[model samples]
Target: MAVLNEEQEMLRDMARDWATNKSPVTEFRKVRAAGEPQAFDKGAWNTMAEMGWAGVIIPEAYGGSDFGWLSMGLIVEELGKTLTASPLVASTIAASAIILGGSEDQKSTWLPRLASGELVATLAVDEGPRHAPHSCSTSVSGGKLSGTKAFVQEAHGADLFVVAAKDGLYLVEKGDGVTLSTRKLTDQRSHAEVTFDGTPADSLAGGGESLLDDVLDRARILTACEMLGMAQQVFDTTLDYLKQRVQFNQVLATFQALQHRMADLFGDLAMMRSAVEGGLQALDSGFGVARAATIAKSEANRVLHTMSREGIQLHGGIGMTDEYDIGFYLKRARVLEASWGSSAYLRDRFAKLGGY
Candidate 1:
């Protein structure tokens, strides 16, 4: 496990308590059952806002605690354990772009609203079937933007969008010329395809490919933290089941073969934790962030892919059923694995960054 300071520990404990008790996986199941339009629990989101969790990384000047990236990662990890569906991660990453590239006026306008959770925000990148950032062909002309952004997280409720264009990143609102079509994710979370037709937009001053890369690196690190959470949760649940589940008049946990499999999982979990912690440390220290993030996400993607598959197989026939919560973890793992960049994409990116 990674070392946590007093503050990070407090934040993590608070988030874990709320996620596990107040809004557990059952709560998420209820949201899916009702087919919530936003695809997340609104009351729970409001509760998180009230807890100041929506702005963990924002500066105090922007109505945030300015707790830094690790603090935010800790919160994300806890929420991931229960598959808590919220806009915190998306909004935080969007705010990061403005903080890094926005003009004084733009920062003053958007940061406070985002920090207060008064406005939900998201990033719209990736226009293709694969995770190709350079393949962005979106155009901006005469202050009007025309493009299509696929698989945008939390787009259903996002009040603002940070769109990637050929020249730079632009800020577009949820108004005229902007249309959103939902793409139902395997995990039942919200992801949308957004189309803009000559939509009026304001350029984020100083924003360019480099700034976009930095923002994405930070987002990747955060995603790794969340995956670490999910992996741990699945392992714990599986281990408990093995201890109690009887097969052939013997507890599965006592079988040597099953024990070895779980032991390997435990080892992999440790390595995943190290990668995630290293990525957080890199971001916090302002060094090697891109490389650290790539390594972390790639390792996490690999670990979760294995854990999700093994978790289902260990659960026997019930694991494949929708009635079982274990299956949801596998579905979410697949979505997240492909979201920012798959393991293959990240490895290639790392190689290119290393001039290989």
Candidate 2:
């Protein structure tokens, strides 16, 4: 387990309580039932902002607590355990891009609102099914951006979008010249396919390929943390089921074969934890972050893939039903596995980065 300072531990405990008592998996179901344009509760988001979650990484001068990425990761992991749908990660990523490369004027204008959660933002990188960074076809001319960005997370109500063009990232607001077509993902969360035609954009100061890459690596680390939470939830839920579910004159947990399978999952869980912690530490200390992020996301892709499958297998037929929460993990696992970069994608990236 990762050792935390007193504040980090308290943040983790508070996040856990919030997820359990307020925004459990059922909350997602409720939002989905209510339909589009209201994918998540704005009130809940405001509550999170009040809790200082939105500003976890922003500097205090910009109206944030400046708690750093590790603290943010802890909160995200707890939320992931319940499959809570919020814009914390997406907004954080967007804020980071600004923090790292934004002009003084840009920072002074955006950071405070972002910290207050009065403005929401997300990154738009993919133009298709694959996660190709260099192949971006988005064009920029005369301070206007024209292109299509797909798989934009938390875009339903985002105030700003950090879009990747052929050259670099451009800030595009949600207004004229930008059209959004909403898509319902497998996990019942909403994403947008945005088309920007001559949308006016503000270029980030000192922004280039390297800054974009750094933002992506940071996003991957945070995402890996969430996947860690999801995997842990699946394991814990499956274990509880094993203990309570009875068949053939004994509890499932009593069977040696099932116990062995769970034991293996336990080991995988430990590795996942270490990978996530390593990523966080690397980012915090500015040491080996690229390698650490690749490792963390790759481990997340593998562990979630395995645990989600095993959770369903152990639950048998009941797991297949919509009523069962185990099935939700499988759907979310598939999306997360595909998002940013899959295990196969990250493996190739790692090899290439190593000059192999």
Candidate 3:
């Protein structure tokens, strides 16, 4: 049971209240119906940025709140309850990469912009189906980058791209030969297959290949935090439906078998909470973050997958219908499971990290 400090609890409360009032589940459904990846209200995004969510993890010098990973996770958990869609995850992870490994100049240049929501950035790493960081097919030549990055979240709308290429990590502008073609995914967010053909890029002066490993681990942990939020939402939604939905002349929640199922889901959710919180603590405490992040992400992936599936299944026919909100959650969960890395992939990495 990880406890939130005063500031953290305040931030959580703020996020929960804002998400409930400004960007509720109904708003998300409306956005999905409009065929937009960003179901989040633009006004709500601006409000969040004003609340310092955009800069929650950034240093204060960079116009940020510098709240740290735990605070960021708390906000994300609240956002997940509504399946809110914003560039929060991408921007935070990208900014963290710069903060952890970028030169002072790089941090000064990008961190403030990211923190202020003046720029939206995403990590472009994957070239194919596999989400392994070492599997980068994107290469660089003569200060130029050339490769395709598929499934790039928010690519269609991002202002900057933090691309991982063979020559190291490069920040490339979104123009010229950098072609972004949007793909409609199940999660209803705008993803794209980004092709960089000799695009002009600036290398992070201080960060080399080693930074790639660090960035990926950080991204995985951040993603796990988001998944934790998504899983909790699914559980809550399913629980609410069970209590209200009548079956066999009684509420579904009244059945002992169903109670056991909910208990199992609660246990899984608890485990995910432990893993994510532990990973955040490890990262904040300057402990060995790679192994901790891998374990957290792997555990999150497994539990989220199970919770999403069971959530929909328990909802029965209504779950399969697009009109129902549980279907949206299921879709988003599936996408998140496939993103970063699948359960099997992360589990394998975790096993190797243990030297098993």
Candidate 4:
């Protein structure tokens, strides 16, 4: 784990306390029950912003703390533990796009509102399913953007969209030609297929050709942070269950076979944490981010896939039931594994980046 500064430690502890007490899985259950198109509690999101999470990576000039990416990852990780339903990750990724590529006037117009949580933003990139950023067909013409983006997270109530086009990234507001079609993803969080037809777009004119790639690396790392948290929670919960759950007149934890499985899972969790933290540190240091992101998210996909499955298997029948929270993590894990990139996708990208 990366060593935390005193402020970062405080922020992580506070987020842990809030997610444990204020917005537990029960709160998420309520949000799931509500079935709103936005799919998260506006009041809870307001609290997150009020506590400075919305501005972790934003500059002080733009009313943000400018705390950097690792700090943002800490908050995201804790929220992931309880499956907190919010657009914090999506909005932060969108803001990072602007921070990387937006012009001065554009930043002045948008970043402060984003920092203060007065507006919510999300990235719209993939045209089809499976996160193909290179295959983006969205186009800009005469200052109007057009095309369809599929599986856009946090789309329903977003005020701005940082859209990727065939040429570059553009900022499009949620008006005029913009329309959203809700997608009932298994996780039941906010997701949509957003379509644009002649929507006015403001191009982000900085950061050269690599801006989208850079922003995506941030997305991959931060997302891996969430997955890391989920994996850790599953491990801890499963271990506890083994200790208490009696089987064949003995605690499952006493069985040699079960003990070995838990030990292996413990090792995987540690490796996942290391890779994820390394990715975040890379973002902060401005070095080797793409490779680090690939490793982080790839490890996250592999480990979480196993962790969620094993959690259910070890828990037996109740694990798959709707009443159990472990089942919910499995559903959410599938969505996240496919988002940003899948294991196969990341491996291919890593090979190409390695010039192999």
Candidate 5:
């Protein structure tokens, strides 16, 4: 874990408390039950905005704390622990595009509302079923963006979209010519396939050639933070279960075999934390962010996959039942594993970046 400053520590602690008390897995269950297209409670989002979580990465002049990525990661990790379903990650990344590339006039119009949680935004990159950002076919003709983006997270609720086209990133609002088709996946969060047909679009031209890649790097690292939180929760919960579960008159936690398994998981979790924190720190320093993000997300993928699987196996039958909370983690883990970039996809990117 990274050594946090006083403010960061306080922010993390406050997030932890809020996630535990105000937005637990039960709250997510309610969201799933409600089956809202947005897949999150509006009231909960309002509360998050009131507490300044919606603006953690925005600049102070724009009504944000400009607290940096690590601070944002801290809050994301806490929400991940409780399986909280909100647009925080998607919205933050979308805001980052504006921060990095939007023109002054664009920023003046959007940043304040985004920072204050009045305007919800999400990124739309992939044109196919997978995250092949380079293969984008979406194009702009006569200032109108047109194409279909698949499996866009938080699309159902977004008032704006930071969309990727063949030329560059563009901003398009949710209105005429923009269509959405809901795509419910294992995670059950807000996801949709958005089709833009001659929708008026404004190019985010300032960040230049690297704008999309930079924004994607941010997305990968932020997503990894949430995976880290899920892995930690699974580990803690499984350890507690082993101590309480007894088989043949011997507590499972007392068994040498179980102890070894937990020890291995503990080491893996530590490594995941190091990678994730390094990525967040990289974002703060603006140094080697791409490489750090790849490592962070890759480690998160490997460790969380193992942790969630072992958590279910260690719990036996109860873990498989719908009535249990552990099963939800496993389901969410699978969906997140495929988001941003899958393990195989990331490894290839890392290798290519190193010229190997």
Candidate 6:
């Protein structure tokens, strides 16, 4: 088990308190009801930036806190508790790509802005729904990109886009032949079907197909950390509910059958935590990040899928109603499961890792 240091623990506690007090479930409810992706409270976003969360994983030279991947995961978990809707994950993935493969000039221009939250960026890699990075059909020619990227999270509000095209990785600004058509997704945040019609773009010099693979690997692990947080929160919330909600003259938590179920959930959560921590360490150590990320993400997906459904099922009637906050976690779990790569997709990748 990877135990956090004092500083990391403090950071996690601070994030937990902030998310609880400032961006609670009620806030998410308001944002979802408003039918706006930008409905994420601007004040909260600014606060997160000020707290240095936006720059948690970016290097210090780029105006970031440089807290490393584990620190980044701690904050992400807290955000999941509130079902906070924002471009944090998308921006982090984009920033990591730029740092890992972009030219020095590219880093100088974008990293600081991204770290400071002055610009929101998202990576466009999914051409269809299969989560295959190599299957990208978006083409680049003469420094221009053309194709449509579907299910782009926060695309409606992003200021910069790090797009993956067939020729290589390209950076597309938010205008000039770039059309972003916002699509209302089930999770109720902003997603878009982006059409690039010969959009002017800047290629990431020296970044080829390997860059896409690198980004996907990092993305998978980062997303797994976030999912770990979400799963933990759902488990904790469900456990709390069982303690208080009485049935048959006793709390539901007292029943041996329910106790056994919670015990099983505890075991799964522990496994997920270990896997995600290992994946994060592997990424930081420059180990086999792709395989480790696939394992972590695949396991986390199974854990969250089971926990989310079980959370609602255990809660009985209140779980199905929007009046309760548990449903929000369930909805967010489904969305996160489909993001980056689905469990089915990751399992295939894991098999490839094992040479099966």
Question: Best-fitting candidate, measured by lDDT?
Answer: 5
**How well is each residue in 233-325 modelled by candidate 2, as lDDT tens digits?**
999999999999999989999999999999999999999999999999888888898899999999999998999999999999999999999
Query: Judged by lDDT against the true structure, how good is candidate 4?
Result: 0.94
For every model shown, what is its TM-score relative to the native structure?
0.98, 0.98, 0.96, 0.99, 0.99, 0.97
Q: Write the per-residue lDDT of candidate 4 for residues 10-35, one digit (tens) a residue.
A: 99999999999999999999999998
Count clashing residue pairs per candidate: 0, 0, 1, 0, 0, 0
| Cα-based lDDT for every prediction | 0.90, 0.91, 0.84, 0.94, 0.95, 0.86
Error of 3 at 242 (Å): 1.8
Error of 6 at 21 (Å): 1.0
If candidate 6 were superposed on the true structure by all CA atoms, what would the RMSD be? 1.3
In the range 1-356, model 1's lDDT, one tens digit per residue, is: 67888988899899999999997889889988988657888888888998998888888988889998888999899999999888898999999999889998998999989888889999999997678877888899999999999989999989999999898888999999999888987889888899999999999877555988988898889988889999999999899999999999999999999999999999999999999999998988999998999999999999999999999999999999888789989999999999789999999999999999
TM-score of 4: 0.99
Q: Is candidate 3 or candidate 5 better by TM-score?
A: 5
Task: Give the 10-residue window scoring lowest on summed lDDT in candidate 2.
Answer: 204-213
Per-residue error for 90 in candidate 4, Å, reads: 0.4
Q: State which candidate, 3 or 4, has the greater TM-score.
A: 4
Once model 3 is optimally superposed onto the true structure by TM-score, how far is the C-alpha of residue 286 displaced, in angstroms?
1.8
Taking the tens digit of each residue's C-alpha lDDT, what string does model 3 give over 72-92?
988887888888888898888
Task: For residues 150-217, write the lDDT of model 5, one tens digit per residue.
Answer: 99999998999999999999999999999999998988888899999999999999998999999999
How well does candidate 1 score on lDDT at residue 65? 90
